[model samples]
Target: MTHTTLSTAQRDRAAGVLLGLACGDALGAGYEFGAPLPDHTPVRMQGGGGFGWAPGEWTDDTSMAIPLARAAAAGLDLRDETVLDGIVAQWVDWAKTAPDVGVQLRAVLSRTEPTASAVRQVAKAHHDRHGRSAGNGSLMRTAPVALAYLHDPAALAEAARLVSSLTHYEADAGDACVLWCLAIRHAVLEGELDLRIGLPALPADRRALWEGRFAVAETSRPADFARNGWVVEALQGAWSAIVTTPATDATHLRLALDAAVRGGRDTDTVAAIAGGLLGARWGASAVPAEWRRIVHGWPGLTAADLLRLGSSATPDLAHAQAESVDYAYLGDVSTLVRHPHDDGVWLGAAGALDALSAEIDAVVSLCRVGTKQVPTRIRHRVEVRLIDDDDPAKNPNLDVVLLDTVQVVAALRAEGHTVLLHCAQAQSRTPSVAALYAAVHRGVPIDRALAEVIAALPAAAPKRFLRDAVVRLAEANTDSPHQGPNTEGARA
Candidate 1:
């Protein structure tokens, strides 16, 4: 139970489960209430549905889980009155504007009750009136309970039911939450899911029931196993997709997620439930970078933001020192990368100068309008100042700035140093400079250079505001008698 006993693998899985849940939620966000995605259609996060979210934006599932995670990070027992009260308060706040809300959940929260008992009473009333109130509501947000109590299965199982009972009073809903939490915890602690770990925690009859259900699930298809509104069927659906998918390698992880999301109705919540366990089993690196860039949640929390929150809940999860990764190459010309590539200059955001320079010979820091000298650990530093606007129309000096950027990067590459051109998010300003650098120094046309950079960094979409400036810069470079013929040269 000590922090010293926690392993790196445990930490990554804990982080992975939460992040994976968000990734699935975001991925399936677009598919909600829509027709089934055709087989082989790439499942990128597009972000428009009944909720009308921006692409990569998670829905109610992750939004509701965030408060629970924050409470767990604060070290409150999830079953405690204070913790449950705080969680429901957050739910009420989120529900006020949430684009999607479960019928039972909305009915319960609408009563303005913040206590677990009050919520449970309301849920029980709904169940009595409606015959079946065992919605997937509780199971969708239960991943964080696994992380909070991962070191103790009995505590996790108990806590999972308590949280579930708040809005899903049915025993099936509570039981499903317990099983899913145990599965997530097992994956985090043992590097894979082993349902036996949770078997002893259930009552004798429920235990026998789940064991048989799981046995049957081994051969069940997702469509048949998981029904959106029923908690037990939802778990069955999630586990079936996971058990049947061939997640033996990176390709399989993608395949597994594809299978999960393609389940159709309520795809986001089900895939999110399945994804948390899958991510816990496979580790965070199993997720692709393009997806990682866009995964975000309500209240403007990004993937990195959620990762830090997950890390906070699990104290043993070691975080790299700010900007600990060294220089890395995003492309042959230097594009999207986590570490600065060796043997190159780094063109990065304002804060990235230190991390970039730590491993390289020099750095070019881009800013909106002015420059400043910064003390650094590395030997060399260059400051490039330009208007930060995305459009060329707003910045009269954009042509001059682009020309200067091209010259600076050309000078660095001529000296045999790799250069990282990075703006914040590396989506706009950085790639623009790199495209201009390619056009001027390598004699490539501006359009061709821009096309190549876009191809290399799929996520780094250059801002269109720079179009006029880029064309002018390309035209000026084309007219130059000194334009080089080495179009194949690397200078990103």
Candidate 2:
């Protein structure tokens, strides 16, 4: 297992988790605690809603997932949320609609101190029912944690159970939680259905049923799988289709989605939730526009926005209520997006100037982002550019294209507008070195460049290697850092 970094798109794979989580929640939320599906949904299941639209909002399942994600962004362990209060503060300030919390979970979130509450409270809640209680809630919302701890399944299941305990207490319920995490783990690594991921972990009874279903090859003669009331059955059914359905086409996914929606009971939700696992594996192409359009709180955003948020290891969207992304550049205006999108954000002083020049009719917003242990800070600009022309560190084919970027605000004291600095989310030798030249040439005070970054960065060339990389970038860019301030200044 190589420890290489994930590419922008590869890292953004979890964007699917976000999208899938939200979509599943919104769609399933419509009918939470509703009447069971028709005794024989075969008829309605065969002819289902177009996008699982019953009032596509989200539920406790999805809502529960939000805290975990915010907790992750804050670097607080799920087992401990000393910083969760800050998250609660955000929720209190912006989230107008309260979540439809599960009975137990509602009580959990109702706690006054996020820090004091997230402790054993999460796991203890499910202790009595960890093995018996099985519900779709945990299975539905565990994707985010699964991706975050891809290398660790126990941690992933622990997160699912911890969260599930807040609301459910059943043996199968806990077991179901395990299946969902496995589904997501498989999705992240292969992005394709991987029955093996779950077969090893499912309970004997559930696993037996799943195997029974898998052994049955006829679509007409549905497998002996049970959809009675367990999360495992639904999850198993979904995964079965994912592996055998060969329905990667958006149309197929769309059709299957409608089938899930109208089948009523857990069937619709089962279909919708499982879709997240499958759709994520196949990528966005497998999801349909109709489903996205009808989903509640979707924010009507674009793929680019999703990708940008994905690169940063966080989804800064309407639900998250980001002050910066909350607004937009309507016309000739501009906005900036600054943050770490995995590999590490490479801030280019010179590239910032060039992007401003590129803005003939586009609106841009520049923002800043903090490092791993820091708080969330908005950068000023997020332009798309290659760090270096000849830096071999980049794989042109795999990088996130047309990135939403940010500026090195500190570089402003020197070149004002003309000064250039290069920054990237990918940690690459060429890109980091490229930043050196762009920073120095764009009048980035040489001392400031070294002091502000240099040693603090992993790729910052060792004193010996730093000189050549810096000189090379300087020689390539014609602009001088010491040059006069531009008419516009450095303000975005």
Per-residue C-alpha lDDT of model 1 across residues 77-151, encoded as one tens digit per residue: 898977798788889888998878988889989885677777778888888888777999899999988888877
What TM-score quantifies how close candidate 2 is to the native fold?
A: 0.50
lDDT of 1: 0.69
- The C-alpha RMSD in Å for every predicted model, in order, reads 13.4, 14.8
Question: What lDDT does each candidate get?
Answer: 0.69, 0.42
Show how many residue pairs clash in every candidate, following the order shown.
16, 55
lDDT for position 408 in model 1: 62
Residue 189, candidate 2: C-alpha displacement in angstroms:
2.0
lDDT of 2 at 181: 67
Q: What is the Cα-based TM-score of model 1?
A: 0.68
